[model samples]
Target: MVSDTEILAFFRGELSRQVNRKLQTVPLELETLLQDYAPADELPYVISDYSNKYGVDVSALDMRNYFPWENLPLTTRLFKGRNFRASVIANRKPLTVKMFAESARAGRWLYD
Candidate 1:
């Protein structure tokens, strides 16, 4: 995985670089806060949970990240919402939100 510094370096040659550059300058506490973001992978019965959360078509969610090395499917199921209990009941593996976004950025997954 690329470190935050390397990601910033990749975005350095642009006029609108401040957005990406700002991550590097942020205080550790603030960085940790933002990095706490997570994807919705553990949600069991996502097809229904998403209906309750967004009211939009969950199937419409095509933008997803997947780790090629893990052979995980690019899925909308991971973006619905939290269902930790259901996941436990179903015996599903949990995936972090960060990995999902990174996968999309790296083109391991694609939206329709």
Candidate 2:
């Protein structure tokens, strides 16, 4: 079984790579939301890389359930309006480093 420390280290390295920043120390806490570290556009790629590297099955994971869309198209912005967009952001469940670590250890996505 992978220890939590190893899992966290993997995330630290992966996140640092995604953000193009070299971290000398733990830059992320277990509860830290991953969206805060990397761009939403890059988040899926990061997760995909992690899933592949750790053999974690993420087929059931939905990106929309965790992070809000980064950029809505012009038509979407106009039709959805600011309130609709705000609600989507407000209702998104946080995808934290701890969750990723847990999933990695479990070899599958654990959150709904």
Candidate 3:
């Protein structure tokens, strides 16, 4: 059985490599690498909260199933991937796992 730790490790290495290499990529490419960590059907939902308050425009989601990959839970494996929809990020920009996770958690989009 492939342990989750192993999976996480491999992904961690890959992410580190990308960072170390200073590689520039689009959200689509990041979406591709994200597969190493999350199962096809298991990717977290990326909700959009235009404002920082009680309102989520579920009707307009940028990424189909794009959650912040960095917010992954290695132990309990319980990550509520959520992100806000900002003008820059919502557009076609390079996606960061950290930013996505932080935005999602802050916006409380996971509940949706």
Q: Which residue pairs does candidate 1 place in steric collision?
A: 39-97
lDDT of 2: 0.77
| Clash numbers, per candidate | 1, 0, 2
Sliding window of 10 residues with minimal summed lDDT for model 3: 45-54
Among all windows of 10 consecutive residues in model 1, the one with the lowest summed lDDT is 29-38
lDDT pick, better of 1 and 2: 2
lDDT of candidate 1 over 9-54, digit per residue (tens): 3223211212334475322221232112222333324324423432
- Model 2, TM vs. native: 0.76
lDDT of 3 at 102: 38
TM-scores for all candidates: the values are: 0.21, 0.76, 0.23
Provide the overall lDDT of each model, using Cα atoms, as 2-decimal numbers.
0.33, 0.77, 0.35
Per-residue lDDT of 68 in model 2: 56
lDDT of 3: 0.35
Could you give me the TM-score of model 1 versus the true structure? 0.21
Whole-structure CA lDDT of model 1: 0.33
Off by over 4 Å in 3: 1-33, 45-60, 64-96, 105-112
